[model samples]
Target: MIIQRLDELAEVIEVPLATLNQHYLDTNFKLKVPVHFARQIEKGNLNDPLLRQILPSIDEAKSVKGFSQDPVGDLNANPIDSLLHKYQGRALLITSPQCDIHCRYCFRRHFPYEQAKKRHWQTALEHLASDNSIHEIILSGGDPLTLSETGLLELLRQLEQIPHIETLRIHSRTPVVAPERALKLDWLAALKASRFNVVLVVHCNHPNELSDETKTLFEQYRRADVTLLNQSVLLKGINDSAPILKALSKKLFSQGILPYYCHLLDRVEGASHFEVDDTPAWQIFETLRKELPGYLVPKLVREIAGEPYKTPIIKTL
Candidate 1:
């Protein structure tokens, strides 16, 4: 279902109120956890200091400026329900407007999910089906995996019915935030069973997010013949350092996940604090090039509105 409030999600996931309370107290109640991860809550307390470092506080959300509700020009697009066709050939379907964790650097934190749902989604699908140029469909949003197994399966079935669509890509952070959710073998099997070539693009910012459990899930995806790619956002105090980036890239490769795109922060209203200027970002890319092989290095890029492709961050100096 649609989870709007944190409490509603906690109850559905069967997470104990005390456990959530402890996490809140650890993060000083300012840090908000995403609904998907909150659903799989078990036991134990997170290291308060470490939790504070990753989780964003409600107060800190107020401090940052320029992070708008509609970052990446999503609102300007002629959205048909959850589908956004800002770029040609690929359609971004906001299958689920929920995420497993409320990342401090999320550009869509203030997005109007309600408006997204009100638009006629089926019209967008029909548009994709009729277009000969549109070959790929990108499942995005808070996170596509937040949608239930049945929901995702139904969506996939419908997508596969279209004649022009050949590639189905899913961009999600759920596998990192809630590893257990990714362990759903039945869902993996169903995804593999689809007619389209399935690709899973995951977002993993820090090496710490890649745990053994995540590794096992990757192995499952591999066995299901799903091509796995990773994209990370450069965040200050999170993963902007060269060493951290290298380690994260190396770890992802070891798990058969390719290093895809390292995106510059989308200058949303609340995320200015995480934005690393182009100068330093290019330097980090240079450092990575020196340390890692060509294939291992993720392309440093920025998403410009109306552009057909991501703009590569080039060093002119």
Candidate 2:
């Protein structure tokens, strides 16, 4: 689908071409919009929250003072080329550089993905085996679920053999963006069959993303041995409102998915527009706290450039 540009999307839905911003569409970053995820957009409605996250806007073309290319310091933490070992006891692996949908605000939009792709995983696995301190492995990237089934299984099987590695965390947008992938993934049970506890972290910004099919997918996970969790980026003009966040939490709870981190947008170059200032961001979280139980309220935090863990924002004031 060439629906990457607002004008292109306008053509598809018969919306006004003049309304689209062409300057930002020229951004060098890759643009991908999967058919399943694109269907969630309201016709002719450019301000649709889902669309806002994926659409390129003029704001993205500006340079915000604090924003930089490697905002989260992925390069600094790259011990082995494909692996990121920022925090102790856990590590993140770039399983692949492919994703089903290209979220405009992705912090890694400007990351040196080519460098990450060139290095194979065997060396990273060896580094893991050498360190008894690290126990959990996080599969991340454009989305690890994008990896071939045979490759994913091989990786999981290898991780399980490492004596100290007790957990395998797979973070992917696949299940939420296209729930059928979750249904068709036959390797989950087998992966769980290994000693490591398997967890799937899904990215969802709105309740609308959790369609009937998505909810059913969650139901399947609940019945299985795998644990399901959701992490939503606190995007401005998206789920910034308290009511929207609360509704998302309630919906997630009802579907057997736990609300995990509600991370403030990383100060990355192009995604500065999505960064909600501290005051309003916390105010929304505070209001959200009043409306939902503690468990349902995800920890609101910021990923400081070189921090070992996500620094939680304990108070709004």
Candidate 3:
């Protein structure tokens, strides 16, 4: 079940109706919390890390400098309505226009889903086939896993015909936020038999997001030879602390996932409230490096418009 109303969420988490109403903001990017995720929040605790990431607040209405609707230049990189080829050798397809949850800090919260054209399916496929330089195709969106079994399998079938494509990468939060819906036997079976190397990069912020269901799902994917990895955003008052991030990494590894990228929050207009400043962001990463093995440390990076790759935040003297 999905919770889209403040009153419904308040009832589940035991937060007072009056108190919840004070901070809630009914914006275009409205509330969309999966029941599986919502149950993990600490009842009556408004400051829960998981809750903070999803709950819309009045703070989103603030106008902050250096923030815009298209923070990562997604629109500029979009050659076609359905495809985005930002980084070389890889292309991202908006496989689905919706997600199970609406994270407050999502950089794509303001994305123009209405603009996604049905005709672009063939256009995207033709473009990918013609570009021998592009070896990997990334399935992203709201969440590609949200697509129906038949729809997803059919899309995969088409991509398999592209002789040059060697890898299939899917970036989705579903495996973490809504494991029940994401774990499909048919999809797993298809991925196992696919010629391309399959990597499923799941989005997870806090350690609390990792649960028994996620563990079971990750194991299933692993058995299918799917490389399981996680990426997190460094958000203010969320998973910004060294201790919290450290815990997250340890927990992820325990469940057969690797820490991939710990991104500095994109300066999307409404998500400015979640941004952690450069000084503290670097400091947190430096501390994290000291506490964990090198491989366990996620690369601290930021996405800059027009940059060839994600720029790493190198600590300075």
Whole-model lDDT values for every prediction: 0.74, 0.82, 0.93
Give the clashing pairs for model 3: none
TM-score of each prediction = 0.83, 0.94, 0.98
lDDT of 2 by residue, 170-266 (tens): 8988888877765645576676466878888999989878888888887776665778898999998899999999999988888888999999998
Candidate ordering by lDDT (highest first): 3, 2, 1
> Which has the better lDDT: candidate 1, or candidate 2?
2
Q: Assess candidate 2 and give its TM-score to the true structure.
A: 0.94
Per-residue lDDT for 128-222 in model 1, tens only? 78788889999887788887887777788888899889999999988876777767667788877878889999988877667777888899999
lDDT of 3: 0.93
Model 2 ranges off by over 4 Å:
1-8, 11-14, 21-24
When summed lDDT is taken over every stretch of 10 residues in candidate 2, the lowest stretch is 1-10
RMSD in Å for all candidates: 5.2, 2.0, 0.9
